[model samples]
Target: MDADATARLLCVGDIDMDLIVRVPAPPSRDGKVDGRRIAQTPGGMAANVAVAARRLGTRTRLLGAVGDDALGREALAALTSEGLDLSHVATRHGEATFFCVILVDDEGEKSLVKVMSPAFLPRADEIMAAAFAGVAHVHLTVARADPGLAVAAMARAAGATLSLDLEAADLPADLPQGGGALADLLASVDLLFVSDRSRAAVEPVLGPLTSEGRAVITTRGRQGAMLERSGTRTQIPGHRVPVTDTSGAGDAFAGAFLSAMLDGADDATALCRANAAAALSTRAYGAQAGAPTAAEMAAFLDVDGVRDA
Candidate 1:
């Protein structure tokens, strides 16, 4: 598919309100410290990625659920303001919107506390079917439901490529442990993006890397990212930038990477652009606020000696 024609990718995941507080340090027990500032923004893995993709010059659509509260309305408005198609975003009554309180220390490290209502979980069938329509690729982010598997199956049925963002979360014992089901889902995905912490939990379940069906990638913070496929592992170094907030760096990477892949850039080049984008995202406060536009990412990539891989 042509780069411009690669528009219409579908993003299925959560949309939430992010409350980012910058403080000198984490408070100790029985101690109190006033935060420097607090900023509320639109967040959630899927929403961040979709906004980043759109800012990077890709047409995108989002399918998810939010509450009917003010926060949910603000979240939906925020995404719509960014030009994402929100036709599939459901608003559930009597549920508070999912929200996260992010604490960022002086060095830019962050700790997150999230509160979610069960109503935020999207119905697997509805989101999957809505996202598959006229979409070239389907990207799934972490959610309480097993919608990832449903979207993967639907993408296959529609002959579209599948991508996933693997996140760390507490799973019920009855569900597949250590990402076994995630590994099986990866078998049908064209690309899988995971964090280094996720590797410790998922590697044992996935075993050795194989490229027969997908590319497995792990993001290593400042160290950059690694791609393992068909027994060959390639490392892409990250760009060094002044740190301000690290909240949405991973989502930025995933968004830029998917945009590059859809643009027909090779894995290495795509990762380079992604790394640049992610690094840039930390140079400012707030998640979507820090995401670079296509021009900004291109300039950074050029300065970093990144070319088509």
Candidate 2:
């Protein structure tokens, strides 16, 4: 199924203001060191994916929340600038917006500390079914189970294809254990973008997926991604390039893969495009700043869409 101009995609998750600081290396054992502070940038798993897909010329929509405060306004303004449909994004009157402190080392590897509030997540009951009208696809970032279930049910009802980016780092403290929560959510999507870091926790539940005709994917930094379907695995090589900040490369991969799928590209072709997009995204700082446009992506690969090697 190819997505045309009228095709719509919905992204659901948290939106945040990121404070990135460049440090020589992680401070050791209470060691104090000075670092250069980068300017605040608006990004979050769901929001970043939305921006990436939107950059590739998809008509995208974002469903999440932010505060009415200045920082929240700044973040919302960023999404608005991307031309994403923010009609379902809520504005909490008195609460503070979620934010993250990302520390990047010389090698562009990062460690982040996020300050999130359950209050910032959208509730399932508050969502109107009418909000999803005309949406052809739904991609969910890590969120509370109930809301994920709600969205999944609606997507099924609307006959929309569903996918999820279940990054291990984003899993809440309580939900990462056992095969229960992950398995429950896994049942909702036909495609999952899991991290290699999550394989240990994610593997046990994956057995059922392949048997059910679902696919599970794992993204490896600078090593491209691997896709598993029907118990068969395909390793797609990554594009190597000069690295700057690796912050949003994976999100770029997820977004680009979804965009390619919308364009009717096969899995291997989509992953090659996604790898190229992720590599290009590391050319600059911040997650969304370095994301390449469709033209940029096409030029880099020197081909519009090449099939697997």
RMSD to the hidden true structure, all candidates: 3.1, 3.2
Tell me the deviation in Å of residue 210 in model 2.
Answer: 4.1
The TM-scores of all predictions, comma-separated, are: 0.90, 0.91
What is the C-alpha local distance difference test score of each model? Answer: 0.81, 0.80
Q: TM-score for model 2?
A: 0.91
User: Which candidate leads in TM-score?
Assistant: 2
Over 88-180, each residue of candidate 1 has an lDDT whose tens digit, in order, gives 888988888999888899999887888878645577546656457778888888623387677778888878898878665634444564446
**lDDT per residue (tens digit) for residues 1-309 in model 2:** 133344388888878989999998878887976789986998888889999999998888888888888989999889888888887888888888988888889998888888976545677765667657788889888734768888888888988888987765555555543546556767878888877777655455344335366787888877778999877787887777878788888889989999888888887888888988899899988889999999899898885344433
Off by over 4 Å in 2: 1-7, 172-178, 204-211, 303-309
